[model samples]
Target chain A: MKRKKLRRAEDLFFTWVMRACLMTAAVVLGLILFVIFWRGIGALSWEMVSQPPSGGFYLSQGGGGVFHAIVGSLYLAAGATLLASLIAVPVVLYIHVYSPNGRLANNLRLALDIMWGIPSIVYGAFGFALMIYLGMRASLLAGIITLALVVLPILARTFDEVVSMAPRHLHETTFSLGSTRLEFLGVLLRQTVPGLLTAVLLAFGRGIGDAASVLFTAGFTNNMPEGLLRPVASLPLAVFFQLGTPFPEVQARAYASALILTVIILTISILAQLSISRLGRHVIR
Target chain B: MEATPDTTIRPLPAKKIAASRLSRWRWFKDAGARTMLGATAVIICLLIVVITAALTARSWPILSAYPLAELLTGQVWQPMRGLFGFAPFIAGSVAVTLVAMAFAVVPAVFSGMYLAEYTSSRTRSALKPLIDLLVGIPSVVYGLWGVLFIVPLVRDHIGPLSDRTLGQFFPFFARTNPSGYGLLAAGFVLAVMVFPLIVAVTEEVLRSIPREMRETLLALGATRWETTRCIMRRAALSGTLAAIVLGFSRAFGETLAVMMLIGNTPRIPSSLFDAAYSLPALIANNYGEIMSVPLYESALMGAALLLLIVVLGFNVMARLVIMRLTKRS
Candidate 1:
């Protein structure tokens, strides 16, 4: 009887601990989101998003904004998403069509999984090495290439999963229609278009928010992105640099930048949701 | 030409000629798609090899010049004088990663269990998105939160509290840092960053387990916790381990949040409060100086290579384990 009672007590204790862990996670998320909003909302303003940083803005002479960083992040992520999708789509389609479960296909999947696991900082280092070998500088073009490397695995893997989840019957139907393999590919893609969009947005969000990979490759500048070959500022790096300043106001601006970034991500998630739900109708499902 | 008796070779009709031309074009297009798309797949596969090669080529100079053991174990990190010992960075990275994993794994597992077993489908669905939000938050923003909140908590509370109590028992808690930016802060920030990943994967794993196991255990008069500890946990062991490994790899490679709070001192930390340098942080911080020094770039690249190899090793192991678990399920 005593042993049974002790077991019950132990179980009760374990249950409570589990509950506590759940509460802790919820509280932590709440705290983080709360802190960001509370500190950030005050510093956010139209001017903050409209103009580039003035001279000595780091010193809190700040009549300027992180406009360049915002725009540059968009430009960088947009270009990278385009490049990654161009490559990822073709590769994913090929994997699905040609050799769905062959050694090459399996290895390719593993390769992408490994790539997805690589730290952005290592990607940054690798990109820097490649840039040096190519005699390239830390310009927008270089940053785009590096960021593409970072997001490619993500795009490819997510799209691959989407493509794989596609009902096999679609393939049969396409073949039964006496369509060529390319036409079958077209039909498969049409069915998974929403998923592909979701994958692209996911990659774009990841690319835009990443800091380590772009820290060296995307050299910062106060100017607006003048050309693809010129150095460009990014939101993550902007927040990092701004917070590094000794001035409180400059640091506050960092919070504002964080808020902007968070808002952008939130928007992307919203779009992903909308895309999946509203776009599900046309999908073969 | 002979199939249709009436349509025997009557000067090769125009329709037949056009049909043959179109079929040839279609065949060419099919082959073109096959080869081109196949090449893309091959290129994607070669990407990892290329990354490894590029990193090795870049870091070869430092590796060839310095003895391997000395470079890895040497303590001093004076790059100006060409002393690029990676001992401190390695220790710092390992320590911080360990700390992060320790803090993260239990809570993550317990929460994952709760979500997977106890919660209704409705609650699970509602909370899963919230957990994903944690994963989606940018590391730099996490860094910002650490700087504003966690660093100060460490400086004022955790630092002094540990120094008074646990400090007496363990040297690891003995030091009281004034700046409050150290391994502990970095680990805490990274813990928050990796928490969601572990939870998501663990929950996924647990959910994939056969529901019959739980029903049988409960029907045998087992409490929910008993069922969880014995049957559910046992079944989900490999998956949970994979989750932990995945989380560990994620924490190990985290750069931005850690960089913000680790104080960037180039020495191995003996205590949680002592400032430390990490390999990723080293690469991130030393970008500007790489151009000035001769082997500085190579040294940093070497650090990157070390980090990459470690993360890659963990990921491959985790992948294999996950594959095993999935196969069993």
Candidate 2:
């Protein structure tokens, strides 16, 4: 009877401890957001988001903005998401449609998982090496290719997960109609469109937020975004560069850029959540 | 009554495509898709080999110039004088990753248990979006938060408090540096980034535990805590380890955030408060700058290659352990 009481007491104690742990995590997240917002809100303004940096902007000479960075980040992340999708879709489709149970598919998933584990800086180094070999300069194209590599495995795996979640009857319906493997894939793809969109958004969020992979490949520029072959400023790198300066105003700009980035990510996540709900409605499980 | 009308030369069901009616164009598309998709899969599978090979071939110049052992173990890191030692960075990487894992694992495991065993499905669904937001926040922003909040908190509270108290128990707790930008701060920042990640994986692993296992424990009159302890230690051990390993791989290769808060001094640090350098930091800070020295770029590339190898090695080890565990059970 005593031992039973002791066990009961221990159970009650640990339950509270676990709940406290969950609360602690949530509180930390809240504090982080609060800090960013507190420091960054002062720097937020219409002109700040509307214009690119003017002459002597880092020197705090004139009106400055991160419009270029906002644009550049969108362009680079979209291009990367597109490039990654081009490769990821075909691979995921082949795995699910052609050989879902084959050894090759298993190996392919493992490879992608490993690739996903690699750091962004290594991708930058590899991109730099490839650029040198190709006799190319730090251009948007180079950054796209490098960032694509960083985003590829993530896109592929998320796509695979979404595709896997597709109702099993999708296979029965598609194949039962005397469809070829590719035709069945088309039907399945149509069903998981919402999940696929969510996956793309997730990958885009990852690609846009990473600064290391594009540090060298996508050369930074203060001017507005130009052609594909030219340098483009990115939001994360903008935050990094502004913070590197000694001037207080420039550092404040860094805070502002971080705020913008945080907001963008929050929006993407909200969209992803909406799409996830829509996914259930789209398919009859 | 409609049997005669059924023979009115009805066309094939629009959706049900039969092989006999497959047009020449449709045939080409089918064949093309197979060839394209199969080839893409093959290339994607070979990507790991391609990345490893590229990094190695690029960094071989430095490895060939100096003995591998010396490059890895030597202390000094003067790039201008042709000295290329990575000992400090490696040690720093290990220390920071250790600190991050230490701070992250407990909270993550507890949260995972709560979500897996306690929460209703409604609560779980509502909480997922919050977790997703946490996971999606960029590391740079986390670094920004660290600079603004954690660094100052350490400078004001943790640094002095630990010095007065923890220093009595152990000398290492007494820090020489008070700027609050050091291993502990970096670890804290990194922990925030990885907490949600570990939680996600842990929840997956714990939920994957068979219902029968839980029922059996309860049927044996075991309390909730007792059952949980047994299950976590035995049944969920491998998955939890894999989760931690995955978290470590993430913390190991993280660059920008650690660089911002680690105070970027290239040396082995004795105290947790001392500034230290990391491998990813080494690559990120020096990769694009002047390459006047002959083997400077090579040395940086070597750091990148080493980072790649370490993270991938851990991932592969975890994969093997998981494969073995799943096979056995």
Candidate with the greatest lDDT versus the true structure = 1
DockQ, model 2, C-alpha based? 0.56
Predicted candidate 1 versus true structure: per-residue lDDT over A92-165, tens digit per residue = 88778767777778889888988888999988988898889999899998899999999999999889989999
Which residue pairs clash in candidate 1? Answer: none
Expressed as tens digits, the lDDT of each residue in B58-84 for candidate 1 is 999999999999999999999899998
Q: Where does candidate 2 stray beyond 4 Å?
A: B1-28, B323-329
Candidate 1, residue B117: how far the Cα is off, in Å: 3.1
lDDT (Cα, 0-100) at B225 in candidate 1: 90
lDDT of 2 by residue, A1-285 (tens): 999899999999999998898888888889988999999999988877999999888986667799999999999999999999988987898888877757878888888888888899999999998988898888889999999999999889898988988877778766566666777778878877787898899999998899999998998999887888898899999999889889999899999999999999888888888888866685756
**Reference contact recovery of candidate 1:** 0.70
Q: Write the per-residue lDDT of candidate 2 for residues B1-329, one digit (tens) a residue.
A: 55555322222343444344555456567768878888888888888788889889988999999999999999999988989999999999999998999899998888888888878999999778667877889889999999999999999999999999997788778876889999999998998888887888788778878878989999999988888888999898888899899899999999999999999999998888889999999999987664787888889989998999999899888766655555444
Candidate 2 CAPRI-style tier: medium
Q: DockQ of candidates 1 onward, in order?
A: 0.53, 0.56
